[model samples]
Target: MTVFGCRICDTALTVPVSRVALPVHANQKYGNGPGSLAPALEPGTFAVNPLPSGSPWRRWAELEAGEAEALGWYAPRFSISAGPVGQVLLAPGDVHGAVIDPALVGDSACCGLDGGEPNMVCVTCGAPVAIRIDDCGLRQATWLDPLTTHVLEDGPGPHPVLDWADLIDQRPGIPPSEPGGGWHPMWAAAAASALAHLLAASGGDPISIPNHQVAKVFRPTLDRLLDPGSTGPERTLVLAGPDIPDTGGHFALIPEHPQTGELWPVAPPVKPIPLAWDAWRYLAFHRTPKPVGRSVPIPPEALPALLPGHRFEPDGQIFLSVLARLPEVRQPRLRAIYDRGRPYSYTYCSF
Candidate 1:
């Protein structure tokens, strides 16, 4: 358990939180209706250094020659988040003894807060301590400023971290469906990292994915990116994990450790493509529509749900950012894709 408090008064600002190795795409923004927006981190969880945004933006030219390179940035962006350390991200509703500063709000035209610096202040001392971001196009989170906040306490207590077996059994799936009848935005964001590693492992060669609803989400992007005619090796991605539903290929797509964010282990010469645990569960224990007897004279085997017809789309910004961080981007064929900004001339539009 951990409780972060305001440095000035030592008053607890946050509820007891546990460490969470959040996804790489945690910061990737998704467009959501004003009324339906959800916080980035789950309640009772907190992630550190989850790419803090705002105020401390730095231009590519402003960075020292080796600084950007050291940051594993092979390409350039308009600006980079040169934000502060000790950024403990939390759900907005989780913070106690704190309130939003109406005067420091961001993107006034929108229904939610966006990029106001130190928008959150200590309720007791009025000390500027954190940033509250909940804009429509950004991930909603409360970012604790290290200078104004200190960890009052953190220690293991009752709820321990789940091991791989327990996590697999839970089947807390990321359903491809969403509120407005489209593919979930989280799936799209996750595709960025998953696709990056898959492409890198392809070695500028062809790779195939088995036919499955979840696999279909990735197949189009993978095919377009790894054009066999345009590009070394060949591989077929096999859904490999404990009790994963599909099976066969030597090339494995497995879940990283949910708690540690560590990629799963694979034997020599076999590259492990990391899949988010939530998405992995969707593929592993897919719930097919089964027949249920009807008293109202409806068809017995009626479908449970109808998925949207639109193709699964990857978030372009996140996809590019993910690729640039991989060593395989140095490969000319793959590098060209990164340099071009997006994989396709026209991106998949769920909306």
Candidate 2:
């Protein structure tokens, strides 16, 4: 079993209680529509870059071969259509080897858990150790703060690769048959987080994003927050993923290493504008609108696919969770952006 420990106190923080196959990405949401079902690909048969060579999907081919090789693309071991599967598990009590620091807790409307800050700390050293996220719509988990913990394996094991097939297959299962099924809180939080990153990437200038589904979801919030009078060359927000092309000068939403949580850049030479990997994966592959009243026409190239059935609600808890984690979001001007919209409310349409 792999062991994760606090760097400062050398205390064992967590150990895998068990290992199970889960959707390769954490933030993916599957759809209820039959056409939206995730495509199943055989192991080792998928392409490292899934987009067609002539596909207008962005310049992922521009990535150096060395960089692509370094990513070690592979297929996911489990399928989401089957059930709730995961590769690792740590029991609740074993999640943190210490008491959580109250000061690090950030506000969350979903489940009242601190999704923004490091809620767990090393008991012996009093150092922040993990983020306890038990939010209402999200799968409860304690993400070890990579900055504070060191993960060690028993031996020199093969490093895991980024599996394109796994990403395509592992979206959230069907929603509960309750009144108004669960809205993906993480999606809103991720969109809000991406918006903050986009602003930072703009270097204090106005920017335009492509008219993709992600853009549709966030434009309202972005328009409400950005200043109309700002002056600078217009920058575009591009989707960067394993298959999408390199982001030439555009602001990129790149994938993350599933195991280590490190982001992979489209252009390896430039600094990345980080978006959660699962968020980028969702934006890149699942572009169709959620199944609702009207049958939204799908682009000829962007065919219908299985995606999560949750209603698209801008979650305040997720927005705050994302906002608090970013340093750029703390700036006085950027900090005020959240207030520009109608005060975030539990009911829909407030943000």
Candidate 3:
């Protein structure tokens, strides 16, 4: 664990926090009109997205000849972000010794940080050091601007290193339902991202997710999108994890560590598709009927959950965002499907 301090005054700005991989949904907007979101990261941990963030974007044509490959994007995008990198993340509540900049709080109807500009300043030096977002339709977090702060590298902090065994015992399961009567936003985002990986693993071949509950969430899209290829056995995706039993299958959808974003290791060398730990825990450990994201009020009244009503659709933007980063996306067969992703709005949807 390490503390973050002001570059000028050297005043400590946060509790000692450990590093973790940036989540796919850190910048995802959950609902339309107005809504609140849970914090993006746990209090004592932080994540850094190596990919660029924000705008002053550059299109493919604008990049210098070899710059596209260097930037890690192989496919064409409307525009690529050219913003600052190495911004440190923290839960909004973890921030201390900072004041919200009244001048910077956005004037949008959401009435909080719209993530347009820095909204918090370092108290010691009055430097714009953090962008604290608690606005509607956005993840709640505080991003310590990379250029304005520095880390205090000293002795290890008091936080303990939790292993897989400890996490399995300590972490609670994630219910698919949200308090506001929809799917858990994180669940929706993670599932969408994972769905993209499953598509890539399909290798342009047809695949089946064996679990009916899992099938309901993914199969509709799978059946509709993937062109059937010459096949002997269609690839199968089985749900497997900490204590979940997986019969022999072509692929396994396993839990990823929530803190470190590390994919769980499985044997027999079956390719892995990572699901969020909490969501996978609920699926693997609790084998009851699953709840649908739509039309069900939470505070359920029984044992077996009601059969899901609506076909689950992964967030389109999230699907494209995850898939666009894959090396396979360079293949024209795969690239065509990627082009059909509806999130971009500009892309014409075949379905």
Candidate 4:
């Protein structure tokens, strides 16, 4: 067994709890500061994607470098003795895959530092760290919630780590076997594709749920659900359709096309919700579903009724237009949008 240790403070740790095998996050500077704290994981537990299952020295180096910079901490330039070390547990090598090793040390090894509190830190760097090993070998469809179990009302089933090749193998669920319903199958596929595309573009090795990839997948899904004839779920309509449904602060999609004067589903522009800036928002353009920019140039007839007594002036359009162009992936812009107010004009279809 090889033990990992931090040279800075002469602190030594064993496998499953040592610097070598343990998950680590820096706590240096974030948005102008000296990071968060040393071994931020000491007081917390966090997941690490694409664990060091194989000899991914280069990948590990890159990850450590980037995370270190973000947290304003650096890896020590030293190696501790591997002997007298605790078990060296390897997490699943792939994010899209799974590891079904039951004895690989469950959550016991990654126990919280502050008397079981999830939040922890390294005494040396004060960065957050969580030493966990995922079962990447056991691939299966999963719910949108990453932490969810297989048998649930979540996203997909047996969602084994699917790649482009894998997509072709399975006969994707066809669009609602019957038309006139919300984004049933096709929407789900587009959403999935979009998510895959975004993840690839964002330099994400393996897509993480609720990440930019997921957001991309959400776009097409929203469009499908927005189709007026779509019967995806009246309940989901509150989150996807134009006019706010009675769902109350839930996500909705536009049912019809606001542009091109067609019934095609429109990809609603992602928006932040008020009061809950961290969440997404969806709104109606006219009586029809209008997802932010996805439904620009509201029909003259629908605009009046949709605005409902509001001055149908260019000012309102301009304000909404400006808001639509905000960046979704950018952290700062996203934060600002959330600071605004949540309204029927915004969409909240995805988690």
| lDDT (0 to 1) per candidate | 0.72, 0.49, 0.74, 0.25
Worst 10 residues of 3 by lDDT: 342-351
Write the residue-wise lDDT of candidate 2 on 1-351 in tens digits.
Answer: 456778787898764432222223233223222222122111211111111111122233554454322332111111112111121223345565767677877665333453455677898889987665544434444555555766654432233343655555764222212234444444554555566566655666666667446565566666766677877777676667667766465666665544345566465444366655556665676544544775776563365433334434454444543454455654666666544432543333354
TM for every model, in the order presented, reads 0.86, 0.49, 0.86, 0.19
Error of 3 at 114 (Å): 1.4
Minimum summed lDDT over a 10-residue window in model 1 is located at 342-351
lDDT of 1 by residue, 105-206 (tens): 765637677655788889899998898877766777888988799999986522468887888766476777787787776777777778887887777767
Which lDDT tens digits does candidate 3 get at residues 1-351? Answer: 688887778878888787766887787776653655788788787877787766568987889876766777766777888787888889877779888888877786365666666788889899888888877778888888777788876434455656777877888667777655566777777787888888788777778776766776678878777775546468889987766655878889988887777888888669899987777777666555556675755443344552245566566677777777888888886788887664452221223
What are the root-mean-square deviations of the candidates from the true structure over C-alphas? 4.5, 15.3, 5.3, 19.9
Better of 2 and 4 by TM-score: 2
Candidate 3 at 105: error in angstroms? 4.0
Off by over 4 Å in 3: 106-109, 153-159, 228-232, 289-303, 306-308, 342-351
Worst 10 residues of 2 by lDDT: 75-84
Once superposed on the true structure, which residue ranges of model 2 sit more than 4 Å away at CA? 3-182, 247-249, 268-271, 287-313, 321-327, 330-332, 338-351
Clashing pairs in 1: none
In angstroms, how far off is 281's CA in candidate 1? 1.0
